[model samples]
Target: MTQATPQAPAFQLHDEPGHLIRRAQQIAVSKFHEVHGRHVTPIQYAILRTLYESPGVDQVTLAQLIALDTSSTADIATRLEAKGWILREVLPRRQRRLSLTPAGEAILQGMRSGIEQMYLGMMDSLDGTEQREFMRLLRKFVHLNDQQNKPVDTPTKG
Candidate 1:
């Protein structure tokens, strides 16, 4: 009789950090949908929120600030423009800058309450101390790995 080959250990998907993070993102997004509906998408909200905070920024800079690819930023901007929520103006050098329309401002203002509740809902599983620690650790995790989102060409020498 031929000897059977040994099998490798089983992989654990549920205990993985990437899987957990992805699931967390899904939960947050689902909550966002439940609260905000089809009025805006998560990326659209990111674009809108960034525009609200930093008005009159060019597309490339906006993309960098939001950690999105340039094309995605442009596409989101177009979608927002289509919805009449944002206005695009060409400056002296023909550079397009984005600004939220009054309608956009109003919409963003309306979203704030739901957004707050969404945050609370997502964090409900954690106690106050755990919530604070989670926020701290999450921020640290982002801060530590933010370079992963940056251009490969931007990596500095060791």
Candidate 2:
């Protein structure tokens, strides 16, 4: 007689950390769009905000600061330039330095209130202490995992 096939362990999708994180991101994006409209995306806002704060940061460095890949950052820069919200200046060696334009600053200022509302709406369900604790834990989790996902300048042969 043939032996019975072994059963595989069950997996719970809803209980997975990645699933929860993705769901949270979806909610955050939805809230952002609701508050800010679809004119600017979350990534675009991040890039705009970073450029506003840093001013004249190179493309690669901007990518690193925003935790985005260079290709995507370049694409976003092109889009922002097209929108007249930012300037991408070419430096020596083909590096592009990004700076937010006056229009970008104006848009950011316009969205300031909505941004605060979006954040408040997202965390409204949590109490003050819980919100702080949640933020702390989230930062801790990202910090612990950051090294593993950081882009390597040179590829390894392994």
Candidate 3:
């Protein structure tokens, strides 16, 4: 009788969905910086756009909306305020209401063309149909995992 040898499992880091998603994010950020320059980061752009649409939202709400932790959101808000791009108002309960300033609006307006170009560039390899399908699937995947990714709400100290 001949002895049988066991084969190694077929596992590849590049083939992992999580790894691919992270790489895609890196490419997106790189493309964003290429178009928008270093003046603002992708996260900051998100915060600015969110505030533009829903102005005067409290810090906690902003954090939830942007899928960020409160501490990070507060830090970003402070940076935006220092840059004169956003205004932060401290509420009675120590919560801060955030809103964009004229400078922030101007920044968004200037980046509009670049934003479109960057998105197009990112998806240039795919056809229109493929792009749409990719986006649809991406949205579905994110939505399905939304609950799992949400930040835990910490109890407030009175």
Q: After superposition, how far is residue 92 of candidate 3 from its true place, in Å?
A: 1.8
Clashing pairs in 3: none
lDDT of 3 by residue, 54-112 (tens): 99999999998988888999999999999999999999989889999999999988988
C-alpha lDDT of residue 146 in model 3: 89
Query: What lDDT score goes with residue 67 in model 2?
Result: 91
* Clash pairs (backbone) in predicted model 1: none
lDDT of 1 by residue, 1-158 (tens): 99999985476888778999999898889999999997799888888899999999888899988888888898889989999999998877767899999999989999999999999998999999999999999999997889746557676789
Task: After superposing candidate 1 on the true structure, give the runs of residues whose Cα lies further than 4 Å from its correct spot.
Answer: 1-11, 92-94, 148-158
Model 3 poorest ten-residue lDDT run = 143-152
**lDDT values, one for every candidate:** 0.90, 0.93, 0.93
Give the TM-score of each candidate. 0.86, 0.89, 0.87
Going through the candidates in the order shown, the clash numbers are 0, 0, 0
1 against 3, candidate with superior lDDT:
3
